[model samples]
Target: MERLTLSVTIDRPIGYDHHGTIYPINYGYVAGVIGGDGEAQDVYVLTEDDKPLESFTGELIAVVHRGDDVETKWVVTDFDVSYTADEIMATVRFMEQYFKSTIEMVD
Candidate 1:
């Protein structure tokens, strides 16, 4: 898959709580991009910075496809780093664990 640059607006920053779960990473959406769920594309921003951000601009690394849902979460990063499927899943498992999902690399 070809990689694309994305500008994400972080609605759920690090430590953000959704019900009882705290977010460990920045979670957001691309303004003009729409997903299968008919909403702005959701994204999980992974970075080594370990700080909350209002927005991020990065390359699309992989996509988290949920078998039972209409939305597919995108994974993006600013660093020149690679992640295995297992590692990606482990990092996003905080919320992804509730869905039947799989990761597909952009490369």
Candidate 2:
């Protein structure tokens, strides 16, 4: 499978919630990678761990293409981890629910 490696700065560590919506995992961005929004590309790190993280390097498994926003959400996981498009959607629904999106599976 083709994979993209991304180094993320974990801003929202596990156990963090914004606006009453709890974060189920780590969420951050590639420090210098720019997205369609003209800023650092944002990322969602999928994991079962509740421990916080300051940074992470993982495989890009999927892309959450938002039809309403200029930016797309990239789904990243452990080097040996795997998650289906459905799983990715389910994990990120808390905030993704606010956007109109389609999951694009990456291999």
Candidate 3:
């Protein structure tokens, strides 16, 4: 099995809102191939205040076997917070950077 791990650190604080409450948050996403096949699976971890809150596993968000590349984009939002696109993009970029740094292997 081929495994990849990516992580990023952000100077800005990160937080999440759930059930009318806001809390510090940390998150990580990982994707990789198995048995040298083209298909891939992904896992997403969401942590609040340094504790695990939720985890989701599913098929890869985007896959390109021929090109030997895969990409995943997650849009996390809190309707109550009303963040703009720029704000969202900033968060996404943070994740992107984190993933780029943390990835251990890709195939």
Candidate 4:
């Protein structure tokens, strides 16, 4: 799969409260990359560390396409590991459940 090195700035950390929806994982964005929403590209960093993080440098493994929204979230991992689409979905469901999303593994 195609992988890109990205330096993500974690804006929303684990347990972050957003309108009563607690974040279960690290949610960040690539510093200079603008996404479909015209902002920093949002990313979901999948890592072994469960605690909150300030920033992460990792590989972009997949892209989450939201049919209902213009923003597409990317999945990144710091460890030398790969995650199936199902696994990625399950990990991000905490927030993705609100959108019609599909994961495209990088190739």
Error of 4 at 43 (Å): 0.4
What is candidate 3's local distance difference test score?
0.33
**lDDT for each residue of candidate 1 in 1-107, tens digit (9 for 90 to 100):** 67898899999999999999999999999999999989999999999889999999999999999999999999999857788889899999999999999999998
CA lDDT of each prediction against the hidden true structure: 0.94, 0.87, 0.33, 0.93
C-alpha TM-score for every candidate: 0.96, 0.91, 0.29, 0.96
- Give me the displacement of residue 87 in model 4, in angstroms: 0.3
What is the lDDT for 47 in model 3?
A: 26
Pairwise lDDT winner, candidates 2 and 3 = 2
| Pairs clashing within candidate 4 | none
**lDDT by residue for model 2 over 1-107, one digit each (tens)?**
26798899999988888878778789999988898999888999986677889999888988889999999988888888888888888899988899999999887
Instruction: Give the number of colliding residue pairs in candidate 1.
Output: 0
- For each of the candidates, the C-alpha root-mean-square deviation to the true structure, in angstroms, is 0.8, 1.6, 12.3, 1.1
* Candidate 1 ranges with C-alpha deviation above 4 Å: none
Deviating ranges (above 4 Å) for candidate 4? none
